[model samples]
Target: MKSLLRLTLSVLIISLVACSILQREGRYFSHPSTISKVDAIGSIPVRISLEQNWTDQTRMDFWFTSQGSRIIPYSWFMWLEQADSRALFRDAGHMEQLRYLPVASSAVNPAGLPIGFALDTDTQTGDAWLGLTCAACHTNQLDYQGTKILIEGAPTLANFVLFYQRLVNALTVTGKDDAKFERFAKRVLASDYSAESAAELRNSVLQISLAVAQRQLVNALPATYPADFTSYARLDAFGNIQNAASAFALHDLTNRNPPTAPVSYPFLWGTHQSDVVQWNASAPNTPIVGPLVRNIGEVVGVFGDLSITEAPWWQRVLGKKNSYSSTVKMLGLGHLEAWVKDLRSPQWPQQYLPGIDATKAAQGSVIYQQQCASCHQVITRSDEGQDYIAVKTPLIEVGTDPAMAWNAAHHKANTLILEGTKKDIIVGDKFSVQAPAIELAVNGVVGLVLKNPGEALKAGLIPEEHGKRSLLADELSSIEDYLQVNLAAREKLTVATKAASLLSESELHGLVYKARPLNGIWATAPYLHNGSVPNLWELLQLPEERIAEFWVGSREFDPVRVGYRVDQGLSKFRVRDDGGEVTPGNSNLGHRYGTELSDQQKWSLIEYMKTL
Candidate 1:
């Protein structure tokens, strides 16, 4: 017994020593400085808006131009700049690589930054970070014949997964090389750093790199392959956001679920007018608060600073002594929502896609009014003069695919959000459906911090007040106050704003899809909620009659088909016919509403839709 005990002690000591050495010498390093800030920047037309109205155009331009968050720091993303010899990212013809970037008009920032990135200097550090904005996914361009028609709200074809995977791999590989680390340090720090600062910077970049690499590895594993390896253009947006929120809460990779049910990105042109938003139509589209919550969740999924490090019980017990850290810029959310609200649907260009007979379209309009107006028409309220789609159509089984709906319906968000009681009374009572506790909690914390900066300073939530913190807090508080006022004045409104105000949480999670106004439906292809059907014409056919499988992520527009060009060698991603390739929550076999229409009638309907 004595000998065994001595051996155990020796082994334990040795293990601790090994761990300590690994911590001190491991290639992965993390420092607070390495987590870059996404500060706001001056306007520099990364992409020009197609909108003709100056006010609306400006907002649309900014909306598509700015990055809402700095998910990856500029230095780490452009790590190859240290080489300066080879063309890091380039393409031969059509400037395909540059043109393919989600940035507007293929224009770079004034700093000659990459597409889909905006340069913003850290308010305190004077260091610039590349931030990604709404345009990365929301903006899209299509080539009709030889003319490039920039569609502001169409789903993007940018290969975000590959871009991120490459980024993670590059950063991790560079971090592992000590010689490379010296160059990275010099490049990222932009000045000579003390040994401590150098170590901190290297550690910070390594930590993020390793985390990303591990996630990519996990996602690539066979168990997660179907869910994670989604095709270009389509992504499991909500599922990933839910997993990200879970990861933020647990601070561990285990919390993340395999992202399944990759759905097409829904255009945002008329989202503000919807009674409830989301592919599944789960979230309420409250006037001020709802948009705020949705945007906050987006920022979190994209590596924004808002996170829940410890469980609520732990947080309650520890109070200011908790082990979590969160930094949020909730102030800008209202502005973002306001800007996006101004976005109008892209009008179909008659000049490019000519040969539409006005007589046929007029006949088609009569067909649309008779056959489709019941569900697809937008009604303007006589009393309020406000326009809204009248129906939040129930979970009618139209059988195109049930995957996205099923995932949205069956999502176990109880663990991801506050349940039973202890919900933040301020925001929770106002809305439901996982009310974005982390965001609201962060807002509540900001409210508290603004009131007592000294207490927050003591708690180490913020550094010394450089005016930005206080200003941001005040703005966030005012927004919060505005939401509260709106909630109180809900009775005065013609439209219900809260989720509970319109439908219960269970009802909100129903297997139904909204029958949105198909004004620009011609622009949005790969139809159905899951994007199973490739075109309006395809959508009007019987489920089995439709193309069983097709390729996505091609920007070549088919005016005749009124959808994206889909052929064998056309696109980067091949959407399989069988459910073999598609993850859970994606099936292309429902919504047989207009399928029974005669062939000529279907053509007429298509012609009419394009006019809208």
Candidate 2:
């Protein structure tokens, strides 16, 4: 036994020594080393060439003419430049207040944090080398909130180069060229612009930065505006700013260029819409956010040679200096385009459980008409003269505000019966459903997020469809029957309707009005018909009363503007110029979460609604 014990001890000691040696020397994850050491080992600096049809001349033409095809990605050099600048613009816009007047430095993403790297090696820079890769945008610095939560991107907007110039200009205008200005500009903007002369201003890096920022903003619009876009801002008979036609409309794919308004602007489609609100957990989705400047540092970082190590297959293909030489790069680019094609793809509802009750809904319907019908008519094709959010009067914070408390009063419409005692309201026995299958359909719809990535790409995953499809015909009939008899009939419910004071038809579709629905309904946020809105939850929270917030040019939801939301990397901002005073697809639309209900009525209705 003693001999056996000695042998075991010796074996253990030998094993420990072997492990220590292997830990120090092994190439595969040698603690101090890196995963790259074993998994992949080649550095490939990407090489880019302008697509044959695209030349530097084309880029110049694109700028002055605003030509469609000429300005877009088919021209490899232009595309690369545009993509990088775009990434940078978003960073800058978010980092600083680009839209609002009191444009202040952001507390989230501070100044420069390695947003873009200019490749400048001998024999490795020039027109062919001057394009942006993945690292241009999309990279995020996780801001440490605490041990559990980490938020990424600080002063989360543009880089120091862009922000500094902007700061200098604003400061020069305000004449607050005090010590703070100097310190802020030098520390944050990182540019020198103290000359009092006009020539000095012109010669300063500040000027160059401003020029770049201006060009970047203009270039953010896609090369081709869809035909549906309409122009609204124009010179009226009075020679003042008047909405004449839709500012942006969709056009043919083969159009010579994106249609121009005397005053051009991006279509705010993909902005928040109400159609998808049934999706709650379905709020902000991560897939919606594409690359920020730093998103793909690994993919777009300085490549050492014509080789790929830690890249997806496609990046590896693009990394090959000869990628364009081989058709492989083309194939890879095509695939990548498809993936990015639906950046604002509607992520199906994560939990679309519309589970509305019928019997209580039946009883509740009567209350809905008495209280809500005056404002939110069940009448068919009714046109209330308010934008979606405006008419709904959606408050930014639900439970936080006394008037617009979302959780405090859910069933004001009386469709929802508060079942519990006065202390705490419970709502199960108040409303009963003839069919419980609504939850099944809602579930199925919500399940799609996990089920069909392909269908989502096609934009077929509407939350309403799930509601309509989820319930059986009888179930819908019951719910509709309850609503119609309760809310639609206009008998003695002598409630005075609030007449909407609207701008003219042209004005309604004008840039200002067309932009109404986009305030803060992030559930449906994404590229409108023009692929404009990018943040899902952010769309829902847009404070329409504050016009400048809409102009931030990036998608982010503010709870102060939108009452409810969840963060999941949502995307989109599509707007339909529904001709009525309100935006499109919203009329006496089906009553889901009956917005027609007053604040109190909505509380009652929502309370009753949750039981369903």
- Which candidate number has the best lDDT? 1
Question: Candidate 1: which stretches are off by over 4 Å?
Answer: 1-49, 52-68, 79-86, 89-115, 120-127, 177-204, 214-229, 309-328, 378-387, 413-421, 424-509, 568-583
For model 2, state the Cα shift of residue 369 in Å: 20
lDDT of 1 by residue, 1-612 (tens): 546534543443343334334434522222224433322222222333355222754544454343346554454444432222223321121123322442222223432343445543344343444566666677677776667776665676665666566566556656677776776676556554567867876666665565555445323423534432465666766666665554444333444445566777788776755666676555555444555556655655554534443346855685432233333334444445555555677666776777777887888888888778887874322211133643555554544455555544444432333333333334443324444323233333333333333433332211112112333234544444534543343322212223222444444324566677776778877787767677788888887677766777677788877988878323433345234564334456667777888998888888888877
Which 10 residues in a row give candidate 1 its minimum summed lDDT? Answer: 459-468
Best by TM-score: 1
lDDT of 2 at 612: 18
TM-score of each: 0.72, 0.23
Model 2 Cα lDDT, one tens digit per residue, 476-508: 332223222322221111111111112232221
Clashes of each: 19, 121
Q: What global local distance difference test value does model 2 have?
A: 0.22
Residue 571, candidate 2: alpha-carbon lDDT? 19
lDDT of 1: 0.52
* CA lDDT of every candidate: 0.52, 0.22
